[model samples]
Each structure stands twice: as C-alpha cells, then as structure tokens.
Target: MKLFYIKAALLNTMLLSFVDDGTILAQSKQLDDNNVGLYTYNPSLDLGYALHTGTSPLKPKTYWRYLGFYFDHRLTFHEHVRYYATKAFTTVQAIGASSIDCVVPIATYGYCLWYFNGARNKGAMNQLKWMQRKAALWIMGAFRTSPTGSLEALAGLIPVHLMLKKLATRAVYHVATLSDTHPLRSMMGEGLLKRAEPHARSAALMTPAMLGKVKSTVMEVDEHIHTLTESFKPFAPEARPGDRLLDRYADRLHFDKRNPPQDRHPYLDELIANARADPLTALAATNGSVPQSNQYQAASAAIIYKGHRELERTHYVSGRVTAPDAELNAITCAVHLAVKQANCQHIMVFTDSMGLAHKAVDPSVHSGQAFSLSVCRALQEWFEADDLRCITFIYVPSALRWDIHGEAHKYVTKLKVRVGRCKMDNSIDALRSQAAHSVLDSWSSTFQDPTYRGSEFLELQWPDGRPIQPSYLNGGPWLSTFRHSITEFTRVCQCITGHAPIGAYYHRFKINKPHSCTCGAAFQSHQHILFCCCDRYSVHYPHFLRDIALFMKYNPKAFGFNRDPSGVGSLLRVGLFLLLEDLSVN
Candidate 1:
C-alpha cells in the first residue's frame, strides 16, 4: 500500500487526506513564477521534500473539488452553491411534495464552510433561495404569484437567509459546548485554562494574521464561543454504559403518581418518621426557588436529620442561573451532608421536583453539570463505602406544604441577596432560552409588517385575541394543530393564504367563473363564508385553530366543492338539528 503524509515547516504547506481524496494548502510571502515549488513525501526515507531543482513548478488551478466541497480560487463557492441548488431543484421536481424534506439538506450541505452574513455572495444565496421557494410552493400547493413569505410560513419552512443564519449560530453554540481538549475548541483559539481564568486565551493553529486572510466560519462565531470545560466530565464512572445513573440506581429513584398532591403529605410523613427512627439512616428535604423580581437570582436550602434529631441545615444563593440549576445544587448540598454522616448506611432525599432529582443523578452533558458532577462524585463515594449503603430520592410537592420541605422553601424564598450585576456565567438552559427569545423577536418584527404579510393574507389570533405569532418550534404552531387531518390542514392553509378556488380569488385573477356565492352573497370571500353565508348558518369567526378545526370537521364541504355522495354530511346536520329542536320543545 502507498502512504502519503507530507508537511513542510519552512514553506508552510500541509495536506489532509480523506479515504479517496485529499486537500493541500500552501502559503507563500509573494506569488511569482520562480517562487513556486512542488511538495512531495517519501515514505521510505521518512522525509518531506520540496522539488524545485530542475523541475517545472506545479500549476495552480482556478477551482478544485475535494471531499464533495468545491473550492474556488477566489473563495466565492459560486459553483458549489449553483451545482447543489440546481440538483436539489431538479430532485424536488421529480419527487412527491412530501419528499421535499430530503432535498433541502442536499442544497445546504456543508453550508457552514461557505455561508456567512454580508459576504457579497447574493448569487449563491439566490440560487438556494429559489430552490427552497420551489419546494415551499409545491408543499403548500400555492400559486406562483403568492407571497414567498406566506408560502414558506404555511409550509413550515424558514427563509433561506434566516435558515442559514440559524444553522450557523447552532454550529457555533455546539462548538462552545465541546470539551476543552477537543481539537475544534483548540482551533477556535480557546484553552483548558480559559474556563478557570476567563482572561486567558490560546494561540490556535490559525494565527490572527492567517485568520484575516480566509473567509472562516470560526470568525463568524463571534461572541457565541465560551469555555465549557467544567460542563463536560466524560471521566465520571456514571457516564459508563453499565454503571449509569439509571442503570445502578433506578430502584432508588422513587415517584408517587397514584396519590394526589393533597394526599401525598401523609405517606411522605410516614416515610420520614421511619427514616428518623432508624439510627442507621439519614433524612433530608431540599427546595429551590427563583424570585420573579430577579430571574437570575436563585436560592437553595436543605434540611438534614438523623434519628429524629436535626443534623445540618445548608442554604446558598446564586445569580445568573435557572430554577433547575438551583434545584440541582440543593440536591448536591443535601447529598454532601448525608455522605458525611458518621455511621449512616441509608439516605433519603425529599424534593418537590423529581425531574430535577433525576437530572441531578444523571451524568449527561447538560445545563447544571457543575452541580450534577459534584452530586455524582459524592454519591459514588457514599455508595461504594459499603454494600448496605443506599440512597432513596422521594418526591414531595412544594404546594403540599409538608412540614420539612415548607421550612426550606420559606428560607430560600426570603433570601435577601440581590445581584446588581455579576460576572457569573448563565446556565446552558438559560442561555438557550435567551437565544430562542431573540430569534422569536426577529421573526415577529418581520411577520408583523403589513407589507411583508401581503395585503390579501388572512390574519389569525389566539382565543384571547392576541395576534398569532410564527415559531419554528415543534413544527410551528399552525401545523401542530390540524396535522392529523389532510382535509382540515389544507383548508387552514388555503384560508391563511387566500389562495383557494373561491369567488374572490377567481375574480381577482380575472378567471371566467361566477364570482357570487351559491347563497346569492356577492364574492364568496373568506369573510363572507366565515360571517354572512346563509347556507352554512353563519356565526362569529373562530379565533383559535381548535375551533377552526371543529368547524371544518362539521362542515366538510365548506372550503372545497366536493359533496358527500353517501350523505354523511346531511345525516350529521339532521341529527344536530333534531337534538336542538328536542331541547327547545322540552
């Protein structure tokens, strides 16, 4: 087998070889015909050599394809974007609308390498945009003249530019969560010491000068990068497959779902009494709270006892945190106290939020890892001390106001510590929530504009009359409502876009058809059908999708021209009318 590994320090040349392909990048002080050199490797001699003596220099190409990415001499990536976009568009045309999802990723593959804001790459972006718009049109079955924004919104697709931005942002944040020893973290100019000493920075493989010369995605990461060395603790034993928290401790995690919160206090009190009566067991109750006045401020308190005698009471307050962070810390402190007990073999922890208790013992890389790691370390020691040593985590709802938990809850709630400003890092969950709110704000700004929504677009609202807002979460709010029924889903889309085959749409498009409703109302528009149509027994238009879905289910032919040949719709109406008449007669 032939093997190639070439590296030249003086000329600054490197080669990265994949299974079937390789990429070589070389640097020079100045570009000249005489200054070019060919880089070669000799496996037999274990040496790298620049063959410039009595040999013609290698010619530089205008573009090259490596590992499925096209690199242009000018770094424009125009050919790459055009190729994929055209390919996706063609594939979308050949496949059913449901398969549009398979083609979107094809057009945006490896986009992190080429996409950035204001790169003067509008041609490339336009190609991808046109491809997405094509798929959106097919998915929604909307006209070519329909507003691109409305069509993509109804199709549950983000705009091309915003999608690119979202992907780029997510990629940056993902790197931020990587372990300190990760190569990507090192390449992004961070170090292991950076988390401990926030001022410390690392010299990366790419120098500042080299970074400036390239259109790099790392440069676009901007302030999103952070040192998460403390968060990722892969060395913990709980992370192992057979020794995971649930694997070794599933039986210890107790939950009481059969009893209501009101009735749980008595059972919980009996368990506490049994624990305190045993000299070998310890009992603890923990509580955490986040004040509404200052969301970042959090407090946790725990009460530990043995043999019906109070042993330790621990409490702490932190800033720039979430409720989970506080709850996890409370569990951590309680376990730490329990582990220090002289001869205790069993420990019991009562928490209001069992979800947080499960999270505390979990060794996964998540929001409150700093607390979770501490909890895991302490519990591992406690569990390994003796075979009989075991812990039980019980659930006691805070609203139940059980004596033990209520005391801790009251203490944590009255914490007077206020943080005007601090340098503490926000928890991962808090940061993610903040970023989501920012993206929602951007969407609202664009969607609330009348011109952007188009003049004929039908606006929707919640039951309370607040204007409906768009979100990409959970398949967006609109699709999540009527996704179970194809007919109802299509009707809602048609209503929102005003692109149905109704009299108003036909008249506006100058199509040769009757522009009057069958009931003699002029222009069978959405407003007329929703409010004034006599055949449908017009009522106030619904503000919620649930109400809309029910209305469409009752009047199946309201939006479409199809009539039930079996007369199921007629039977449903007659049954409802007879029921109404019987109530009146009674």
Candidate 2:
C-alpha cells in the first residue's frame, strides 16, 4: 500500500513538472501573446471561456508542462511529443510488487521535482488558492504512506504561497492616472481571477510606457462607472469611499471606483468594447433629416376635403382657434396646430405674431422673439414630431388674395392684392383628418374577406415619349406605373390642395403635373393629393402601400427604384393604414 501511494504521487509529480506555469493554456499556440481577448465589461463568467474554447466548468485544473518536452507549432502545422516509457527496466517494485525499490534515481528525481514544482507554483501569491489544493494532495499521500520524499516536498511550498498571497493585498494600485484598462479592473473584482502566475505582482507594477495602452481604458472605465451610478447611491461599502467621495461624484454618476469583495470574471470588459463601437452618437450628430417643408395642419390625423364643385382649390390650417388678443393670428396658428394635432404642447413657436405659441402654452417662449424670415422658414418645415417640428409667422402672406405689407418697395410686387376680413381656410387640417378617416374606412372595406388591397396606379411612357395608362401589376414594368401613381398623387394634391406640388427625392420616373380635378371651391394641397380628389364615393383610389401589400407583397425596391423609402409619402400612408387595419381587425 505504501509503495502504491508513492507511485501515484510520483505520477502526479511527473505530470506537473511537464507543464510550464503560464504556457499551459490549451487554446494558445504562443505563451507570451497577451491577446487573451478583448476585455468584456459585464461581470460574467463567459469571458474566460472566450479566450480558450472547451474550458472546463471545473476550471483551475492544472495541465502539465516541462521545459524539455515542448509542443512545436509551425505556421501551418503543430506537433507535440509526450514521453511515457513504462519503466527503465522491468521491476516488480515499480510494477506495485512489494518486493524492492528498483526504480532508478534519475526517474525518481524527475518525478519528485515535477510534483514539488507544482506545489511551489500553486503556493505563489497569484495562485495560492490553487496551490493549496495541490499541496494537500501530496501531503496527505506522504502521511498516509510510510515515507515519500515527493509528498514531503509538496508541503514545503504551502507557507510561502500563503505569505505571498497576503503580500498581494498590501499594494495600493493607482487605477486612472495611467491608461484605459478593464482586465486589471476585472481581476480586482470577485470570483474571476483565472490568471495564475508567480509573477502576477511584477506584472501589476508595469512601467509607464507599458501602461500607455491600458491606462486610457482604466480612466474610461472610471468615467463610465461614475456615470452609470450617478442616479443611485453605492450599494456596497468598500465599493466607494466615505460620503465625501459620494458627494463629490454625486452629479457625475458613473462607475463607482471602489473594489468589489473579491476578484471576478473578466468577461464584462468585452461588453464595453462592443458598446463603444456602436454608431448611435454619429447618427444623432446629424440631428434628423429635414422633413418636407409645408404648412402642417390637421388633428386626429389630417384630412383632405374636396368639394365636388367647379374651380378646384384647397387650403392649409390647423383646428379653429379662439381669436387671440395679440399678434397677427397666422404666426401662432401653426404652433396651435402642432400642439393639438401632433401632441407637442411644449412648442418653440417662432412668428411675427409677437408671442403666439408661448401664450398658447406660455407667452415667455413665443413668436415675438423671432425675426420675420425666421418665422416663415420655421413654419415651412413638414409636420413630423414635436421635438423635430417648429412654428413660424408671416404677416399673413395673403388674405383671400396676395397683399404686400411692410415697406411697400421691399416686396418686389410681381402681383399684389388687397387684404380682407375673410375666414381663414382650415382645409389642410381637415384633409389630413379625412385622410386618416379614409385609411380607417379601408380597414372596413372588406367584411367577409376583410382584405382590402391597393395598387400604385402609374403613368407609363416609352423611350419615344408616349404617355401610357398603368396596367395592373404583372411582375415587370413597375417603373411606368409607380411614376403614374406619383404623378396622379401630385395632381390630386393640386386638385385637393389648390396648386401645391409634391416632389420626390429620387425616382425612376419624372413626376408629372396632376391634371386638375373639379372637387371643391378652394385651392389644393397635399390633403387633396392622396384621398380627397380621388373617387370619394366609390373609395377606389388606394393611397397607401399596405393596401398594395394586401394585394401583393409591397416591394419598395421593385422596378429599378433605388431610394430610401422612409421619406416617401406613400410608405408613410402604408404604415398608418396597416396599423389602423390591425386595430380594426382585432
């Protein structure tokens, strides 16, 4: 039994001696490469597994490495040689026969040194915990058996390993004065310090030049830590300094620069790396793409009302307003429209009407503060969200007719008419509301099937310039039809909106002027273009693509059309219609 225990101890010793302390990584070809991985920022265990595939859940298990029996790796091929000769000679004692000590000194010496080396390696401060496990196995073997020098040798490494482990705690590590760093920070956290090396203390005290790469990371981590926790107090005591540090960092609220109870997983740094690479900041830098300029009006979705009378015309305005005591009303009008329709009460209204939006919400932030041209330009922007929209004023560009105000000569009078006490048109807002209603109606268009489909009716033209009526979709020649739909849409707007022309960003076909329709007694705008001027009785003119998608899958990229579909009016209509349909159907 004594001989068997010594033999097992010898086997373990030999295994340990074969492994080089830092070079035992199963995944890495080069031991010195610090390219373990990008530092993960989240405190998770997966980061270690990322460095080496097939890492065992039972990690901290040691692999054997000897200086002589090396694994040689070429650029293309790798080779390893493991030396395992059964015995120097056939000996009964070595074969576990309680006969005699027949094994040679060289083999015995080699085996003893291997186990002793492992025991010593484990006892090092950086790996003291692991070393204890190693030392225990050998010491127990030595005592359980009569006497084995190998087991005795292992116990020798324990006291020193414990002392150095204690020494490691005494160092005052300065984090941010140096560079960007995450892994070192990870190590200071609890549970994930997988690195086991005798030289860990030396590595921690790197030269300034060496830290240049990582120093910035440490500072960044500090900034992030400070920012994340600004709203909340520190949850742990050692995690932060006294109330003074907390007070100083109160407003900043990021990473808390305090130690966790123990070293933790290094994978968290990986998450940080990924977050930094995202491009949202760059996107926000541009603000948002400028929306189409227009007199935005309407509420509960803008409406387009077309009179089936002669002299087709349309107008733009929000809901009816209670007469304001101050400033020309057109200036505050858009702001009022924006608040009620778009739900933007905190409107930054700018108009010649001294203080309109401000008074409507708060007079302090009103139209009077802005210049004249500022007001006109501000109101011209298309209706979007409140955060991205604004209202401006004009001294009523025209009443019933074009009236030039201010300095008589400042306006190059191409054609000027007189001002009158006429009722301002709120038709644009009405049309938008009607358009929303039309979409809702489409949802109810089909009861049995409940599947109402719309197609883009297009204007077709050949290379020789013969205008053609759009054919129903047959998988090809969509360009002519799409152009026709846009043309009809623009023309309908002219009929419904009174001479307002809608333009495209990029298209396969040129937009055609819409033929005037005898709808109402007012001018036309965007409200008339989509749902108003079209057949309001039969409801045949489908204004949105979700309608088209109902018939066939709508492809914004169909038929050589190469433009982002976001800004397209048709696409917006589709999304709105689809949502309405869903709500009604459900």
Maximum-lDDT candidate: 1
Error of 1 at 274 (Å): 4.5
Model 1, span 359-466: residue lDDT tens: 887887777776887787787766767778788778887787887788788878777577765455566666555566677677778877767666667666544445
What are the per-residue Cα lDDT tens digits for candidate 2 across 1-586? Answer: 4553453343212111113352323232343221232112112445544433433344332333345332323311011111211232234223521111232221222222222212322212223233333332322221222111122122222132222222221111223111223355442322112242223333244455654443332323332232111111112221233432223323321222224333322322332233235321010000001112222222111111111111111122222212232232333333333334333322222222223323322212122212122333233333322334333222221121211122111221221222235533332222233333443333223211212111222222333344322221231133223333333322222221122222210121244643333354143233343334443323323443434563234344322111223224444332332222121201
Each candidate's number of clashing pairs is: 0, 86
lDDT of 2 at 179: 22
Q: List residue ranges in candidate 1 displaced over 4 A.
A: 1-3, 6-18, 21-65, 78-109, 190-215, 220-222, 226-231, 234-279, 291-296, 305-314, 352-355, 396-411, 416-419, 519-522, 538-586
